[model samples]
Target: MTLEALERRRLGALIWREKRAEAPGKEPLLRAIAAFLRRHGLDMLEFPPALEALRARLQFVRRHEPDGGWPDWSESGILAGIEGILDGFLPERFSKNILKQIDFQAALKAQLTYDRRRRLDELAPEQLTLANGRSFRIDYSAENPVMAAKLQWFFGVRSHPALLHGQVPLTVQLLSPAGRPVQITTDLPGFWGGSYKLVRHELRGRYPKHDWPENP
Candidate 1:
């Protein structure tokens, strides 16, 4: 009763093509595609080498892991991304048939490029300008984006720098004159109003030449 691997793959492809022709809409087609893959097993379904490469690249970019160390692509992630693109960006009249006819690699490349640009605009930034007119580059790859700067660089700033459209605060890595991290905090005001004096006391004797203003 079991089908051969080749037979299963052919069946999967045939079912996919038939589902597209039959259902045509995004949601319905996605459901059909998911069912087809699940029933036949994705390993048996041979995708074009170029198509697979594009899919992997798209997944990698979307996950923000450009270092080529991304984990293996999961079925759910691929399915979700496909549904997202079909529903969000594509025209309402767009359907699975277009996927068959179009230059998918080119289309996917354009989509990935646009998405990367949009995310860079929205979530990540190279530098944050403090109230003191000092700009520092932020490391967005970290779980919490970090900005390592000299304590003096933040002297005039009373509040923590906000990022991610002013919703999330940056983790400030306050460095000493010798470029050592003296304090790490996300709450600038709390550190300035409380622990800063204690730290100033400890560091003043070691770095007597550096300015440590009482009010800053």
Candidate 2:
């Protein structure tokens, strides 16, 4: 039967029980209940619980699969995982109804596909090549994405590398040959013209073996 018809039948049964208990003055109560059900329908009662359950499931997946590996689009697969979870929680008929209401597997597949397309392997390169031909691996797990390269590697670089269609600037940790961070800046030009002279002097005394270029 249609969902609306089922809901109306259920409401009628409930109102009939209420009327039997308090027969004298329940005409107004029954009329009001019927009017309210007709006006609002059953969406307010149905959708919130279903949405809350879906949200909880999504959160569980995220928490358990920080690496986006669960639902493993490549292995056991997203569709299988979604179907398994839904089937485990609901009866076969109910699960089929929910699946018809929302294409959970397709939604998850779209998300996984988008993630794959923009995966660090595809879009955000792990190692970025500098002007000096030196390459540094970017660490995306940090609060701000960071790249640690030797100060000399950024000698002629006037700006930090921009990623994600030039929307994100990498937090550069300029290091010495010994891998000690000498300076950290998102603005390469500002550091080169500003605090770099003092940093250069400190590094010159600390590591005289390394080239501390005056112009750089």
List the candidates' TM-scores in order. 0.51, 0.47
When superposed on Cα atoms, how far off is each prediction in RMSD? 11.7, 14.8
> For model 1, what is the alpha-carbon lDDT of residue 88?
40
What are the runs in model 1 whose C-alpha is more than 4 Å off? 1-119
Q: For model 2, give the 10-residue run with minimal summed lDDT.
A: 1-10
- Report every candidate's CA lDDT: 0.63, 0.56
Residues 106-202 of candidate 1: C-alpha lDDT, one tens digit per residue: 4344454565645644555567888989999776545577889999889989879977567778889999999999999999999999999998997
Candidate 1 versus truth, CA RMSD in Å, comes to 11.7
Error of 1 at 170 (Å): 0.9
TM-score of 1: 0.51
What clash count goes with each model?
A: 0, 0
